[model samples]
Target: MATKFALLLLALSPLVFANTASADTTNVLFLAGGRSHASGEHEFNAGCRLLAKALNEQSGLDIQATVINGWPEDQSVFKDVDAVVIYSDGTKVIQHGWERADQLAKSGVGLMFMHYAVHPSAEQGERYFRPWIGGAMETGWSVNPHWVADLKALPDHPISNGVTDLVRAYDEFYYNMRFQEDRDQVLDLVTAVPTRERLKRVINLWNQHGVNGIGKRQTLMWGIQREDGGRGVGFTGGHYHRNWAIDDYRKLVLNAIVWVAGADVPQDGVPSETVTEDALNENLDTYPKENPRIPLPNVEEFMQLPPATNVSMEDYENAKAAQKNRARKAKAKQLAK
Candidate 1:
């Protein structure tokens, strides 16, 4: 009787584990790089949290963020996980690291990627990353003179359905990846106008290195593919926390994850409205004072305009007048009382 009862318990264990693995929403595993500066910690983590929340609320998908400071040793971590979103660019010190993750990912799990996650490595370049991400950086991307984002043409792709034609974004945009074989591997491409310096560089490089169209560039904000008998997607512009709240951005990212997860299409379709990156920086108070080596934009630059140092009465008078008005209003109320 004791042996029979023990056998019955063992039989049920596998059933219980199988049931647990079959989740309502595809399980999303997130791996992020650590913050170099104090505020960056909050910024990077919050962005992942926002992505998970929106995927749950708007797309009805289950998402969990696990910040892998370095590569985790446990291989079974991906056993129940349906998809993995790698936010970490493999910059920090990790034990097993990108190579380990790469091997596991090839075993048929879905992948979603962004920003530094696609940044070039000695082990991999645009070619290697392209298969994993559906796109790779060729090098026109930059954070300087941070330009505005404008969504251009898309291929009538399901992933891009209802996505807006224009939404402003601020980031260090990627440049230089031309499709290796065919454009059929691409789903959508979002671009922004290049700075004059960028334009000239591309032209000169085209003539010099036999690299055609080096500068007449647009950043690839979105890239996707059906490769390795699996689905994969990537976004090149998720380097900031404030991007989470923008309506278009919120929908774009949520949709990307859902598509990667092989889930039902969203009912309301993609969101239409969006906020300017500058507005987000000003209102959210997310950026820092001293420029840290953080890769994304600084929110504080928008919050406080430069102090009136060595300025004339034109500037001082406006501030002074505003202060005087506040004082007058307070005085009037006091006297009335």
Candidate 2:
């Protein structure tokens, strides 16, 4: 009877554990920044909502996703979250709540920063950002340029589960991040060679450092499993909100969110429905009437568009001046009306 009972318990253990695991739901919190940039650009709030919708309805996992505009005044919102994702302009969103964020990190809560959120002040980068997210965009060292990144390959990681095809997109992909001293802990999930020919526009902090980095293989997205048992991810390619329409681009980010939340990424990754044109335009921040709506890129045509020739500093400055003049004229015309 004792021998029979032992075998029966073994057979039931797998089922029991599976049930327990499935019952535990992962909660993901997205702290989206306030309105900034032009129309269809830095749609932080909109982007967060779209991603949250996918996690809740399409991920096929027991996950609850919430999006809070800016930092929550109520501190309790961070209490039960399995992971916190920040998509904003720099670390300004969490500037006042560093203590609380650190506490969460210590307690093994995952953290992720998208686009400009990864470019914190040097002091903050060394103190909090690097340790928490494995890497950050250091000013003078890193460069943000609008370029076509051919993410031709991905590492065999949970974050790369369903990312099977080439993810080619033109956006402000920041490169040459400052990583922690122990780089062995940081896992490079997505990397692309940023050649001069691929650069469309060299803006913000694009100096000699950026010019010298041409043809270098830069890590566009990365993940790290920290010593504290928490996870961290830094992705520098969320600049163009419209790029979310691309399947592979969207899947890569969705997969990272699930992975960082301490949940098992599905074998086929987090499945999300095809993002339609109407969906892309939804929840956009208010911009001037003169700012034209950005059209959804036809993936094939957009990807096939030839790379721009090398951009020079003089050319960039001239373009900036022209853009300013155009904006001024638009505002003047609006006033006349």
Candidate 3:
């Protein structure tokens, strides 16, 4: 009788452990990098790290967000990931065919594209994109501009779940996107209108792109439930990394990630801890502030200043990197809380 009781306990242990492990774990992969921009802007890696921190710490939901600076050198990183958020140049990242989009789609893995990540070159659009994300931002047909957009109304969707008063910011918004033809397959998440005064000012600029014919109401964000039961989202914002500091903006993004991850999005959206500017600066690309394109300074002349003075790009980076390291330690403390 004692041996039989012991065997039953051992058999039940595995089931109990499996249930606990599978219940709330939603794994996310954030792929970022590509073009460089000025200080505090277009910091894809840094933005992604901060986003991961917000999701892990702030969101009441249980999620594990991994920030990969670029596509992983090790393809195994793709294994078991519930969803993916790409925040880089679409063509550059997707060009090599390193990732198998079909397997992910077939497995119902979710996807989210932030900013320029929505546009893959015409060549690769149909092959990998159409089936994965529903559509790609085709050039010539698409008009991208850096303008402030007022998101007065949002469609009812899981991404918009828990959002009551949406906050609008002066971001580098790219409007006039050319989405999939069968509009019913995609659900509009955010509908925004560019500032009329600014739009009037940039008429010639808009016309310069041959924007003679464009729609006034723009759909800047959408959610796609593919026929294969996979999920996807495309957001044409995040050009200005600073926008992540806004609560509504962060909430919307967090919810989308959770929803696409095959998890239950909180009714109030993904709850993130209040993010600080210091936290935002963490894990930024160590590119020189003066020359955003180059990774480091070209001359010793700029490197002569005191470390704190930040007279040169490297000096600034050192200071910032040091600050970020401290912030990371603090992140561990936040998790403890």
Kindly list the per-residue Cα lDDT of model 3 for residues 156-248, writing each as its tens digit.
677777778755665556666566678678777777765433332121113223233233667777778887777988888887766777777
**Cα TM-score per model:** 0.62, 0.84, 0.77
Flag regions of model 3 displaced more than 4 Å: 3-15, 199-215, 289-337
Per-residue lDDT of candidate 2, residues 1-337 (tens digit): 9999999999999999988875697999999998888777778998999999999998788999999998899988987789999999887798868988999998999999999999998889999988898999999899898888888536678888887877888889998899999997888888888886677667767766677678888889888898799999999988788898888889999999999998999988889999988888888888657556667866556445566433566765677788899999999999999
The best-first sequence of candidates by TM-score reads 2, 3, 1
Root-mean-square deviation of every model: 13.0, 5.5, 14.2
List per-prediction Cα lDDT, in the order shown: 0.52, 0.86, 0.69
lDDT value, residue 256 of candidate 1: 67
Model 2 local distance difference test score: 0.86
Following a full C-alpha superposition, what root-mean-square deviation does model 3 have from the true structure?
A: 14.2
Model 2, poorest ten-residue lDDT window? 302-311
lDDT of 1: 0.52
Best by lDDT: 2
lDDT of 1 by residue, 115-194 (tens): 65655543354435566656654434322122344545344555555664565555444454544355576665455554
At residue 254, give the lDDT of candidate 1. Answer: 65
